[model samples]
Target: MTTTSGNTNPASVQLSAQAFRDVIGRFASGVTVITTCSGGRNFGTTASAVTSLTDDPPMLLICLNKSSTSAHAIRESGTFAVNVLAEDHVQLAGRFASKLPDKFEGMAFEKDGNGSPLLVGAIAHLVCSVSEQVEAGTHYVFLARVEDAVAYPGHPLAYFRGAFGRMQMAPDASVLREVRERIITTVNEVDQAIDLDRWAAELAVGVDLVHRALIALVSEGLVRREAGQFVIAPVPESIIFESYTAKLAIELGVAESTVGRVSQGQLTQLRQYMEATFEFIKDDRFTDPEAWIQANERFHEYMVELAGSKILLDTYRRLGLPGLNARTINRSTYATAELLNDHRKLVEAYENKDLGAVVEVLREHADRPRQLRARERELFGRA
Candidate 1:
């Protein structure tokens, strides 16, 4: 498991190429297609071993297999362009990764300042002139000084464990929902400015995905853009009061619309959520507010789902009630016993098929967040 002077130690366990590849595959990498032009011919290959070597003069390096046409073209032409692929470039990545005679046969690409082909729709394009080329084992590491670069805001194509993929948040509804939930939860937990890049790195998602989620939050009034940065929108007392007022109206309407219509399956799901919430409460596990918030949301979401009104549920979501609830709970110093009791009453009313009791409990539940208005105002301080 050790190497000395480029040689594996005799006593250490050595790994085959496939074993090394498998182990390194756990380190996810962004996919890029390295393109170079030589003698009026285009050559390209999918690459992942690209890195930013320096930032002062802006330089990068890409390691290419010595036998690849791109490596030969870059060495001959002294220029290459690194086109960082987007999530939608899976087919293009496959084409370049193949041994196709002319990878750019039917492909459309624009030449960079260095006469290197830059693929369209790439998240970034870096045109470079090869400054140094060192042969390492079976590959040539080309150290290039970036002549020009352009970046587009988009999710990146990713490679992991021998498969081409994209970051999980974009285009996946369930993943996006979870991302959105986590973002809101984080915002609730912190009073400082939200950093999209930091959150993306921590969540193992693309910054573009965080930006998209923030934009969705903006539409819901949970986040606001200021100075080109996303921040949690301040929740004033009046807004909190107004939010609960609206929730009371909506949930009462939902209760009337569903009542006896809720199925045993839906009831069973709601009961499961209740059990989870009570278990967390019984164990006094409030250290992770995000978990409690998610459990609470699930309980309410099941109630909304029982109503079977997509329009109503969508409208409620658009109001950003989840974010509002998080803000309320996190800011308040009050005990959650009352809130837990309200939930128990809500479930009981639903089980008994009592429309009046359901409406009453929903009203009480809606009113609870309003009690946190003073604390929210103190924390957020005037809008």
Candidate 2:
């Protein structure tokens, strides 16, 4: 609506339009693909502006640009369905938001009760009959009565700053800690089957969430899947030592191939990670086990990444040295100076492009873990 008064300033009116878009664009909204059928044809477009109008009347409102073909179709058909997208539907949302000639081509969807296209895997679907519409400047606002609505279990897709993403809620850290602690203490016997349901009930978490944590444990080499069940993985000295041996070989190869050839930027990053390697053992004493292993892995990983082999990097990571370090070594008594010096020497050798020194340092560094493991047994009185 425009007020045609002699007092109306044209400049102010023009400024308001641009100001309005800039202001409203910062507010995030859930993504939806509005669908309708008209004249024996299917029409769909991705929509960002939608809100529940009233629950008592089961009505909702959606706004689309005046040029939207789907909006015209909805008006003609007098019905539409708003398919609220799941987080995984970023590509689907983009496809519909484009100017493609056939947006619905090769897409899997079913018709809602009102005969509007309901997208598969959507988090929610609302079938509506257009009750009224208003033309507001460059957009059309449709107020509809929701005839049928159903919602599924999933996270919603979010639109912000002209980009598509997810509205994520990070899992509680305490829950993760509890799950890891419980699994480590209870599943002492190697190959013992893990009871996810019992853990969920005891911990007051969802079974699916517990299962997610189990997968994380598996990647950390703390759990193994066998016969369609999760089981405690054996992390004896032999297994840990074998992983060290494997890591040693891969690190040598990466160093020999990469140290002399690394760019200056890579060199700077190497130094950064090398300095972090001792962050957990700054005062020649072990402070945080998790921080120690993470720092240790980051430094070694920087070396391996310099080799530029995704396959090699992936193989090195699958060894799960960080997790194994936590399991094998006892805290409060780990050798720290040796690790700190080894990282320092490796960085210095890389700076000088001395491949021989690199290999020499890595070889000696590999033996330190064995020495530490022995020291750990002696100090903690654990065989």
Candidate 3:
């Protein structure tokens, strides 16, 4: 049989038609009603090929068979809307799927604030004005701008090949248990004969266990690993990705987590680490900024680790110490003195065990750098 990864040739997989359907049905997709209007006529089609591409000025894409009548209308009109279907709209979905004479004969819908027509009970609707179109094989893919949108509280209708489906959230306890099990499995799966470096040594677990655990963690939507380490997935990159607010938020989070946890001994170790870091930067002796950057990251790691949330710590590690971006440090623009001052505030916050104040300071600590860098960037014209 052909594996899911498509590693084996399709011809090698021998299966009856029914069996083929069963196997191909494993992949899941969100059901959507794609709508387009042109020449004063509106048309709708059921599709599963809609997906979001970005949030900044929000964008989404929908692919359609070029031969589909609706595809021609969308191309002519230069606009369309992807209405994410609700579970109860299976009949509506079917109606759109067919090339019936008048699919919207009895359908109830209203023109949205944008010119797009919206199905009344859709879970979510994205009214898009086409930005670009690309032809891929027989499909004309339209990337569009989210001009407007609306949503109603309902379960999303999902599809896997031929059948409809829905997403169900697992209980937290069960999820945690599953994650632990996967981690255990990964720790044991790594081949011992393969001499792993120090970083890999920290991952002393079975290969499958590690793989499954990471997958589970990612799938759970609680954590994310941006590069080498893991950290909390940001709620919205709208503020984080393109703004200075993002950097500050990251720092504040790390600081708060660090200050909220750890013993006096741990604090002392942290203090020593910070002082050593400050001294190294002051000496101007280190030629390789990466080494300094690593040490700088380790200091923050101590704080994040002390926060006692493995998930948070993992996320911080993943974000790779936002304050130490290579460009920021390499250009000699890093605020080492400011960081040391922040460290003192973090130590005080830790000693006082004031969670509220810790969070407050952390937030400010994070925002300050981002705000300044933004201004700097504005002045310097994209540094």
Query: Which has the greatest lDDT?
Result: 2
TM-score of predicted model 1? 0.47
Model 3: lDDT of residue 200: 32
Per-residue lDDT of candidate 1, residues 7-74 (tens digit): 56666566678777878898999999999999999899999999999998899999999889889999
RMSD of each: 18.6, 16.8, 22.0
- Please give the CA lDDT of all the candidate structures: 0.78, 0.83, 0.66
Candidate 1 residues lying further than 4 Å off, grouped into runs, are 1-11, 168-383
Least lDDT summed over 10 consecutive residues: which range in candidate 2?
Answer: 1-10
lDDT of 2 by residue, 132-202 (tens): 99999999999999999999999999998778887755445666666765654442356788888988899
Rank list by TM-score: 2, 1, 3
Q: Give the clashing residue pairs of candidate 2, or none.
A: none
- How much is 204 displaced in model 1, in angstroms? 25
For candidate 3, the per-residue lDDT at 156 reads 91
Ranking by lDDT: 2, 1, 3
What is the C-alpha RMSD, rounded to one decimal, of candidate 3? 22.0
lDDT agreement of model 2 with the native: 0.83
Clash counts for the predictions, in order? 0, 0, 22
